[model samples]
Target: MPYADVNGMSLYFEEHGTSEDTVPPLVLLHGGFGAGEMFQPLLAAGLGEGRRVITVDLQAHGRTPDVVGRPMSMEAMADDVAGLVKELGLPAVDVLGYSLGAGTAARLAVQHPDLVHRVVLVSMPARREGWFPGVRAQMDAMHEGAADALKQSPMYELYERLAPRPEDWPVLVEKVASMNRRDYDWTEELSGVTAPVLLVFADADGISPAHMVEFYGLLGGGHKDPGWDGADRPASRLAVIPGATHYDLMFSPLLVPVVRSFL
Candidate 1:
């Protein structure tokens, strides 16, 4: 278990493939209430030779130690990521973050644009006014002794398909419990990202069922500046996996080709 002392916490991470394989390392960030290991399916899908993969467990989750003073703000998470990359001597890397991780990745690309070459944001929430109230309420409910809600959640159904059994339930429960409530903002951070972006989501994903329209609309609205100079904004790609939800699309056979084409 490799660990990096970063941002007042011991961050856990694993490196796969080799830096020699790709020019820029691929940094993988998992979903909310998920550890970096969520990318395992993608890794097994065979992303190709010479593509190094670095998966990180955010602080206080998985094998990482929680930072004592800092709440798990996405900004802090981004800083942790930046520190890890610098500590490991990585020059620049491509970033792939899913769900909550996607939000953090967006912040990173905006705040530390020079450190990222390309970015893939999967199953992210649409940045619309008042869009997060319901979701936040649900998460808050779960945190405030409504743990039973987890059993009825759409995400739980997806998790069941991935890891079924009473024994595995604790892993999922701990993940939800460990999530920091304050780190769920994407409104002000989305516009600052400058990396070539790929947005991937499923049509029926509970968190992002209408994500394609909203996400692509944001990209094309011209209201958002990609933080690039005139005429050189990194291109964006939007892909909606048909007939799949969030959990299903992760291991769905369709995702591989799209990922390979972009990354």
Candidate 2:
């Protein structure tokens, strides 16, 4: 029931494990059309041990209501998170983001380097063009008219149950679609990201493996073999969850274990 007035909306958040932490809070950001509840199962499995875990419901998602006339975009969501971090008075925190939230998390780290210590980007592309052509087509196809069709999805059911204004599902769809319409390329921004990062992808993800390696390179990874002395390894790392696709990767048990080990 904790809500922070962030960027003109009531941004809802929940804390788990020890409320206070010297290890820095682990902020979990969910994919597009998902709420923080998406992470509940993993947290319930004890993923938050020894650290404070914070799950945030992004703007217009979950318990948070959409503000009139505000179109959803990566930048906007990132700014909202930055506001939330500042509002909470967290000097620095670790971030784990998936898909839409990944983009937001990356942008937050890029824009406010001092606020983010380490980052984990799951199933997210460095740039909009990193997705497969078919995935791009599907993303671009999202619209309000597709709302009824989307009802068949579990995401829609989650929305139907938890959204403050379930009747505005169509509006949410249109906003996401609108945000997808814009082109975002953060190639340069990512290369200069100061914080150490972990780029995680599924073996059969929407993003190609070639692109995943390229993303790793941007964070100073996969360029050359690290010395056996373990002195020359890049702070950044890459992880691929076998037998998982973007849709199911979030739910994969391996996902939490990898993230828990990393962060």
**Candidate 1 least-lDDT 10 residues:** 162-171
Worst 10 residues of 2 by lDDT: 15-24
For all predictions, the C-alpha RMSD in Å is 5.7, 1.2
Query: Which ranges in model 1 have alpha carbons more than 4 Å from their true place?
Result: 19-22, 126-137, 144-188, 207-211, 221-234
Best by lDDT: 2
Model 1: how far residue 48 lies from native, Å: 5.7
For model 2, what is the C-alpha lDDT against the true structure? 0.89
Could you give me the TM-score of model 2 versus the true structure? Answer: 0.97
Local distance difference test values of all predictions, in order: 0.70, 0.89
Clashes per candidate (backbone, < 3 Å): 1, 0
